[model samples]
Target: MRDSVSKDTLSDVKVQQRERGTLWERVRPGSLLMLVATCVGALLVLSPFLLVVLNAFKSPADYSTRGPLALPANFDLGPLQSYLDIIDFPKALTNSIVISVVVAVVGVLISVLAAYAIGIGRIKMRTGVLAVLLLGTMIPQEALIYPLFYIAQATGTLNTIWSVIIIFIVLQGAFGTYLLAGVLGTFPRELLEAARVDGASRWRILWTVVVPVIRPTLAVLMVFFFIWTWNEFYIPVVLLNSQDAQTIPIALATLRGQYTVDMTVVNAGSFLSLLPTIVFFLIFQKTLSNGVTAGAVK
Candidate 1:
């Protein structure tokens, strides 16, 4: 009986050891390292925005007296209120919304059509056309700034919101086309053939079948374009010299004085400016994720 009990105990111990080893193998050391790396990367990426929010609530005296990374002694809304009042926040916000919306909607529309032509229609010289469009994306915006300025001046579009809106539409539309074309190219040809066999015109098929299938991609592009246009500084600053036509970014820049800068107030404005983009992403994050992964499966 003693020998049998000892043998049973030994077997049980071995079983437990095997289970523990299997669990460790499933998790693996590499997975732990990846998790740690992901956490560190997230912290690094969010640190700047977190600092902006933390400093925004502090008073100028507190911000100056204490370290920038330090927590605010007390929360206050006065600085943000003052910043808004001084900068004419409503006017700038309105201009930004209008420009961003117009650019996003119109640009996406143009892109969808162009993408359909090259990707679905499979027009002649399609490869060459796509190569040219992709090349446009590689060109630095700085290189075109001079030509854009000259063109805007000659056309009497200087200091106008339309100038900024039109420029963004053209640039963003090209990129959107490239992205959407890739997604559309992966679409099953059988679906298009079926639609064609059903006596559906190319336009009808695009609107009915293609649009529904690619709605997620379009949503992603619209959100990106809107956020980009809303936060654009360089083009708006160079083109919109007048205060009345300036967007939120240009308006925010005016918060800094030539002689003296208020770090707290600037932080407040920066935080407020980020609100729209944060809200937008929260609203469309699901669609954006779906769009990004849509083509991966098939």
Candidate 2:
């Protein structure tokens, strides 16, 4: 009887042990790994921005003497104030804003229309055309500096804001269209067909159906174009000969001198240059993750 009882208990315990298994197995390893990776990536990308923001509030003495890792014992707004006064911050800011806004808006608009035409419209030799467009995106713009210089000079746009705006639009929009075309290609043709069945004209369909559905792609393009245009240094430095036509990037570069660099003021100016893009992202960043991803998938 005692042996039978012991055997029964052992059997029941073995069954329960089999049911318990490992908790880790219940949670997906891939998901856990992805979460860890995403957190690390976020920190890596955002650390520089955060560091600049923190340093913006530090005095020149504090920033240079103390290590960057150290926190300011007392927050100071004086550095930003002094820096702004020292560099005619308002004028630089206005130039940056105007150029960035123009480039982003125009680039996205033209790219959207162009991408739609290539992706959905029955353009002749589409594969060949798309191949050409791909080449345009891959080619380095630096190679065309002299050609652009002559063109700008011939067109009488040298040392003007319009020159920068126009160049940026064309440069960034090509790449923007490349990305949007990929997203647009993933869209279902049935929707366009249905719109046509309802007697919607091509223009109407593009404006109403296509634009609304592809807002995600457009939003992403806008953010990217704006950031690129705002940060553009090379073309502006080369083309812009006058201070009045200078963008924030050019203005910030001018902060350096032959003898010494103004670390505090340069950091302050750099912080200012970043603010517009940061604000734009904060406003529309949802498109980056969900909207863009969903549109691409759809």
Candidate 3:
């Protein structure tokens, strides 16, 4: 009886080991395939950016003759300099920076205040207000262009950076309010009550308590707003007719001629235009990630 029991135990162990091995084998292939697919997707998304960077260093002659994808036979800085001269890179970049920064800062401030009122304060008609704000996001810019142009023209803001900045602030503020309202709604009510009980005024409570707690979310919103403002093309093009007020996208478009466009020069300017946004993301990526995860978990 003892010998038979030992043999049965040994058989059971062997069977368990075989099952474990089979499970691992199945999982390994699926995981490998997922990794491969992710890599392929990343490659596809990054290929155009890579092409722009690569072609930026090439000469117009090389770009035209050797194909856009080809490596430059020799490094050439002429196209970059040419692009800078054509676009007046400094003025365009400065205008973009000013417009984007002011929009982001003002937009965030308005959004946080509005979101706090709606989400935390639980004001009357909060739901209706949120719905309207979100509805604004759905309205296509194309539809609003003529109306916006007329408004800018009447206001005498056309052909000025403020025209773009004002529009950006309003549009971005609505989006920020929508995002932050959800995040602020998840705040612990007890904390606010405690602040009030300790004699904190509404403004003090907002600045000292609510702001600190929701800073991550604010960072995320600011980054998004900044990027959107920086990349805004349509409004700037429609409003900023003068060369002095034009931003990077409009300047880049101006590089293209009706008859012919220089691929290398265009690529060079495009790559240069992307640098500020890339730097901004790299700097704020950690905060952005934390904000996203915190919002999700809360």
Candidate 4:
């Protein structure tokens, strides 16, 4: 009994010593270096955005004279107002929201259906289908632009918002198909088998079992789809001619002049353009983290 008590006391002392160590002492030098490197990399990545915020409210004179790094003399709303005047901020904002939401929803629906068929249906030639989807996603938008343009013109969707919306849904669905198909491929079959034994229809099992289990991943895909569609400049610029039809990126791009650009106004427009995606990511951040971790589990 005395020997056992002495061993227990020694173990307790060792644990206490570990707990009492300073955090810096506990963290290895390599881990500390990684932490510092991560912080620096994050700051470097954020520098452009920081510059935009800094200059967004500055006067033209203040920015040009003192340069982009200098602080603004006053929080001038002029640049923001100029952006609003040059482009209809509210109208363009509304168009972008509508297009992005539509694409996210429709894109996810198509992907889920394709993934279901490929991942769970045990379809023949599944490998061929996956290869096709992978190939489709790899094709650059530049290569497809002309064919898409011709189709849009043929269908009378040219210069309208629907053109871009349709383009993204088909394109984005390809990626989501590849991602979710892989996820569903590795999905535990026990739940599916149980559902089948319970006489559940394929559709019923999909909704009741499969969908609920993978919802976090779907949310992440939806958020990505929305942001990707929202940031689109090339497609919208080519397809949307009217100011009222333009999305925020295209609207901001209009601020650039031929020889010289009004950078203060451009920065203000950029901030406005970036705001929605940031807000969206913040809203879905928890789901995104859950999705990433869940994807790693199996």
Candidate 5:
């Protein structure tokens, strides 16, 4: 009887114990599994960056001889310099930066206004308005390409950087508005009431009270919008026909041939292209983390 009780206690303890060798506690079977899955996902997401950095320094001869997976015998900046010259990289980089920054700022403003109206303005048919914006986002860009192209041409903005920036501002704004409206809907009413009770106007309240409270979330949105616009390829490729107006993603595609691609040169350009966004993300990462958790805290 004593032996059976001791064995049963040990079994119960083992069953309740956290699964070892992983970072997460095994509160249930799902938690340990989720930890493993997250690790795999992080690695998959980071693999492309690793591959680009690895091959970017390799010479064309070395890449062809050793295949794509092997380590480089020596680092060479020749491919990096050559790729930069081939694509006139500085011009592309500058154009990309300007367009992304403009879109991010404008997009955030549009989202804030739209969200304010939908979330707190006591407007009629608020759900309808949100539904329309949601539908706009859901409609695949492929289906709207023709209409967008025709509009751009008619406006005489075709093949210009403005075309890309304008399109992204509208697109990004719609999504941001949809997302931010939800955030604003649950805003602290006591704060808004206190502001209004103190004789503040609506616009003043927004900029001073509401905007300041949600500034971290807005920063996250701006960073994401900037990155999204920076990575745009399809619309820019079609609309910005002029080589001078093309963004980095479009410029990268121009290097590929019908039959073959230069892996070394392309990787060098990819590595360079990846750097600015990485740096931008790193700078804003803390703000992003805070924004993500802000809603949970209060």
Candidate 6:
């Protein structure tokens, strides 16, 4: 009995030693170097955003005269205050929110349906259709501008928000077809075959089975579309001629004059413009990660 107890004691001691060794291993030189490097990179990336945040709180005089690195003498909302007045910030915010939500929703709906058709449905001429879609992606927007312009002029869509939204949804089809089709192709064939065997219609199977399985990919695509459409400058600038029809990008760019610049209010408006994309990415980062992993698992 004593010999067995001694052996047990020695085993416990060895386990404790191993635990300590592992803890020390985690704190070694290489690990410490990696930790430091990550922290430095994060700080460097965040510095510009921090500067903007700090500058947004400074008065125009403080912004021009005070050193950027120096702590503010006092936090002032004058920059933000002035921007709200000049740009009609509240109205612009509402416009941007409505445009982004509509574009994202419509883009996702159209793309998801197209992807489902191309991804899982077996049909003749599918390869031909896919080729055309991919060819559309290869055609640069710059190259197509003339045709798009003629279409807009002919359709009476120029200088309108509908023009922007319609163009966004059509542009989404290319990348959207490719991305979502790839994701849907990864679904197990057995799940689909089993669903069909159980008498579920194509639409029913899509809603009940396929959608839940590929929801992560859908979330990733939605967030991606939202960011791209929100930051889009060219399409909106070209299509929206009037100030009232203009989105945030044009509004912000117009803030800078030919002879003089209003850095204070411009920075504030730019910061505000970045908020939607930032919030979206942060919110959907986890689902994005999961979608990538789920795709890989297939």
Clashing residue pairs in all predictions, respectively, total 0, 0, 0, 0, 0, 0
Q: Ten-residue segment with the worst summed lDDT in candidate 3?
A: 289-298
> Model 2: how large is the Cα RMSD against the reference?
6.3
- Put the candidates in lDDT order, highest first: 4, 3, 5, 1, 2, 6
lDDT of 4 by residue, 1-298 (tens): 9999999999999988878786548889999899999999999999999999999999999998999999899999999999988899999999999999999999999999899989999699999999999999999889998999999999999888899989999999999999999989988999999999999999999899999999989998998899888888887898898887988888888889899999999999999988988888888889899988987776
Q: In terms of lDDT, which candidate is stronger, 2 or 6? A: 2
Model 1 lDDT per residue over 1-298, tens place = 9999999999999999999999988997889999999999999999999999998898988988997989889998877987888898888888999999999999999999999998887889988888888888889888889999999999999998999989999989989998888878888899999999999999999999999988877988898899888878888899999989989899999988989998888989999888878887898889889988975765
- Taking all chains together, the TM-score of candidate 4 against the true structure is 0.89
TM-score of each: 0.86, 0.80, 0.88, 0.89, 0.86, 0.86
lDDT of 5 at 184: 92
Cα-based lDDT at residue 197, candidate 1: 98
Regions more than 4 Å wrong, model 3:
1-27, 296-298
Clashes of 6: 0
Q: Model 6, range 180-298, lDDT digits (tens) per residue? A: 77767666899989999999999999999988987877887887788788888877787787777878888888888899987878878888877866887888889889977876775
Per-residue lDDT for 83 in model 1? 87
Instruction: Residues 121-190, candidate 5: write the lDDT tens digits.
Output: 8589989989999998899889889999999999999988998888999999999999999989988899
Worst 10 residues of 1 by lDDT: 289-298
lDDT over C-alpha atoms for residue 119 of model 1: 87
lDDT of all predictions: 0.90, 0.82, 0.91, 0.92, 0.91, 0.81
Q: In candidate 2, what are the lDDT values of residues 1-298, reduced to their tens digit?
A: 9999999999999887776765556778899999999999999999988888777777777878895777876688887776777666677778888998899999999888888887887478877777887898787879878988899999999999888899888878888777777767776789999999999998999899999987876777787787878888888888897888887788888878899975666777778888877788888778788665874573
C-alpha-based local distance difference test score of model 4: 0.92
Task: Tell me the spans in candidate 5 whose CA falls farther than 4 Å from its real position.
Answer: 1-42
